[model samples]
Target: MTDNRTDPDPVADERTTLAGFLDYHRETLALKCEGLTDEQLRLRAVPPSGMSLLGLVRHLTEVERGWFGRRVGGRDLPPLYFSEPDNPDGDFDDLDSTDVATVFATWRAACAESRDIVAASSLDATAQRRDGTDASVRWIMLHMLEEYARHNGHADFLRERIDGATGE
Candidate 1:
């Protein structure tokens, strides 16, 4: 893969720095999926692990919706890709018949909504978590950055094993 990701400026303010890094990681995940066919995307290249690039995309869509839409925005939205108790790993495992274009579009929309939610609130703004504990926008942003960074590492390995393609 081409390392087209731009680095966040170290001198920027906290919000800018966090947003930049988060955006970069998001783009990196997309880049990793680029040029892949739906079948290749759904391939569990790493084996034993049920994770596929398509699965990662679906999983992140749910993450984005959970954190930004449901929690921060306080919207009563149902899970987009998976449900607990049954098909908990549906996001990662239910890929054989998934609509690739729809899934990708949903992921993009979720990211856009997440950006909007972040924009309308201050970093200090608080929202209630599932346990009724409050969380700041700052904390959410950092958590999302961490989430994507970790998943992108998995994406990196999967991409490498899939095509011998390498690098950021």
Candidate 2:
């Protein structure tokens, strides 16, 4: 097996902008989730803490749809959580959707969509959330960055459990 251990600090340089932070985090999360099989990636905690690398990817995809596509782009896309099913964890409980090819394609699509949306708008541009509250593109970028950071931390532990290797 190939060793995937990284430098442990994915973002060593200062991300000077919110968009930069978002990009940095996206990369960091991808790193944490990398080099694992679908089985290893989808392993959940006891009774399922509803946590997994694939789950995080799904959740982040939904977040991208909500924050960037719907809010920032003014697109009325279907909400992935409330309308898709009744699962409180949203996209985290995908035990049956374990097809690696499908999950990978979906994740890549989500990342591409998010990048396009970010590229199309300025940081100061404002958009309303589903609740009709205002959100700046800057806010979405920063929020996603933070979200990825927290979840990637979870992924770190999960990966460690999957294999003895740990770092970054």
Candidate 3:
């Protein structure tokens, strides 16, 4: 996106913006699901936990919407992964095979919107935390990076279980 796509140097300082953080997570997630089919991606790797690669993708999408859309975007969007009459983990619980395409598309869209919001503001810009605490865009970027890195760790193990593959 920075006209550096062809840069062979893998060590380039690519993360100069919060959008970079978002892109970093997206790439990490895609790696977690590399070469996986919808069935493999949705194959709830852990039964009792109901955590699958697809679920994580769906969950991350919801997280972005919740944090950036509802909280930072300051829109009255509905909550994800939580519903009174519905299952508590909506993102993980929904395993409808037919919805795979729709879910992935939605995830990508949410990420784009999140990037747009970050691109429109200064990383030092402040926003209220979902809990009404104060935070800067930089804080959100760092938090999401930490979160995705941790989840990607879990995803590594889960992905290996799906089909042995590993990396940062």
Candidate 4:
């Protein structure tokens, strides 16, 4: 894939740096999924793992929605994929019947909403977590950066395994 991801500015302020890196990683994931058919996107990694490019997209959609929409934006929204105590892995596991276009659209929407939330809030602004602990916007962005970095590694492996294509 042609990498169009913009590198995070090394000397930018904390919020700018975090948001930039987060956007870079987000673009990385999309790059990994580019030029693949729906079947290719759903192709599983090695056995015993349900991970796929499509699954990663779906999972991150939930992550963005959970952290930004619910926690930060304080929107009372329902999970887009999995439900607790029932289908916890629904995002990754339930892909057979998913519409790729819808999943991608939802993910993009979630990301847009996250960007808006971050733009409007102070870095030090706090949100309540599931455990009743407060999480600052800065902390959440950092956590999201970590999450995307980790998952993008998986995306690398998955894309390579599928088509022998590889890059940062």
Over 3-32, each residue of candidate 2 has an lDDT whose tens digit, in order, gives 343333445543335555666667777777
What TM-score would each prediction reach against the true structure?
A: 0.94, 0.80, 0.82, 0.97
Each prediction's RMSD over C-alphas, in Å, is 1.3, 3.9, 4.2, 0.8
Clashing pairs in 3: none
Q: Write the per-residue lDDT of candidate 3 for residues 97-139, one digit (tens) a residue.
A: 5477787788888888988887677777788875778898788
Error of 4 at 130 (Å): 2.0
> lDDT of each model, Cα atoms only?
0.91, 0.72, 0.74, 0.95
Overlapping backbone residue pairs in candidate 4 total 0
For this target, which candidate reaches the highest lDDT against the unseen true structure?
4
Per-prediction tally of clashes: 0, 1, 0, 0
Clashing pairs in 1: none
Candidate with better TM-score, 1 vs 2: 1
- Residues 1-168 of candidate 1 have per-residue lDDT tens digits of 556778899899998998899999999999999988899899896548899999999999999999999989888879877788887988898799999999999999999999999989899999888898999999999999999999999998889888878877
Give the Cα-based TM-score of candidate 1 against the true structure. Answer: 0.94
Which runs of model 4 end up more than 4 angstroms from their true locations?
Answer: none
The residue pairs that clash in candidate 4, if any, are none
Best TM-score among the predictions, by candidate number:
4
Could you tell which candidate, 3 or 4, scores higher by TM-score?
Answer: 4
